[model samples]
Target: MKISEELKYTSEHEWAKIDGKAATVGITDYAQDQLGDVVFVELPEVGQMLKQKDEFGVVESVKSVSSLYAPLSGKVTAVNEKLKDNPSIINKDPYGEGWIIKLELPGLEEATHLLSADQYLKALGL
Candidate 1:
């Protein structure tokens, strides 16, 4: 499993890539593998407010449906509409075209609660 050092991770397997106040969120490589082949995604609406550690959406796989969680609190700015038709992109390129949402983080303080890639790998016993 590849975990990029540039991204922050949540215990729920969500990953966030911070870019100033804006952030792009997605499930990690480990998550996609665990979920098996992704068949569909139920993305949160743009402009919806989400709390840190809260369920924001769902990723349905051939095996089971899994909820996608927010790594930090914020208002959703955009959702990747491409996922509706190409959910398998998550399994093919989870950190790129597979990104699920973009959020305007409430504050930088919330970022402190997230884990570094190294820490995240340790948490998973990698």
Candidate 2:
């Protein structure tokens, strides 16, 4: 399980890397590991609005299908279109090339509610 010190984490297992008012979001390494060999990703369109904790997409793996949650209230600025053709990239590099979406954050302060890498590790009993 890889946890990025630079990113914020949610209990539901999403990670967010904030850059000013925009954030890149993805399922964590732990999440993909649990899902087991991702085969498809169903993501929202660019320009869609998402509330914090909303089910923004779904990830389907050989083991199961799981909902992908929003980490903050924002408009989606971009989606990882590459995943449509090669969803297994999420299993290969979840924090890098496998990032799911970029969101235009309306309240950067809401990020304060997110867990740090240490906190997220503790939450998982790691």
Candidate 3:
């Protein structure tokens, strides 16, 4: 499982890469691995408001369908439309091209609640 040191993680297995007031969010590598081969992604529309821990979307894989949660409260600035046609990119590169959404954070301080890469690894007992 690849955990990004530059990103913050949630216990639910989402990751946030905060850049100023903007944050790019995605399911973690461990999450994709657990879900098996992704077949479809249901993403929230751009400009949608989301609260911390809210269900933002769903990822449907061969193994199961799982909810994708918001890692922080924010308005979605963008969605990864490419995933609609090729959802498997999430399994190929979850933290990069497979990022789900970009959010306009209400406050950067909300990131404090997120775990670091090491902390996430420890949480998974990896």
* lDDT (Cα atoms) of all candidates against the true structure: 0.93, 0.96, 0.95
| Segments in model 1 whose C-alpha atoms lie over 4 Å from true places | none
lDDT of 2 by residue, 14-117 (tens): 99999999999999999999999999999999999999999999999998999999999899999999999999999999999999999999988889999999
**Model 3 per-residue lDDT tens digits across residues 1-126:** 787899999999999999999999999999999999999999998989999999999999997999999999999999999999999999999999999999999897889989999999999999
TM-score against truth, every candidate:
0.98, 0.98, 0.98
Please report how far candidate 1 places residue 68 from its true position, in Å: 0.9
Q: Name the lDDT value of residue 101 in candidate 3.
A: 97
**lDDT: worst 10-residue window of model 3:** 105-114
Best by lDDT: 2
Clashing pairs in 3: none
lDDT of 1 by residue, 11-84 (tens): 88999999999999999999999999999999998999999888999999999999988998999999999999
Model 1 TM-score, 2 decimals: 0.98
Model 1 Cα shift for residue 63 (angstroms): 0.5
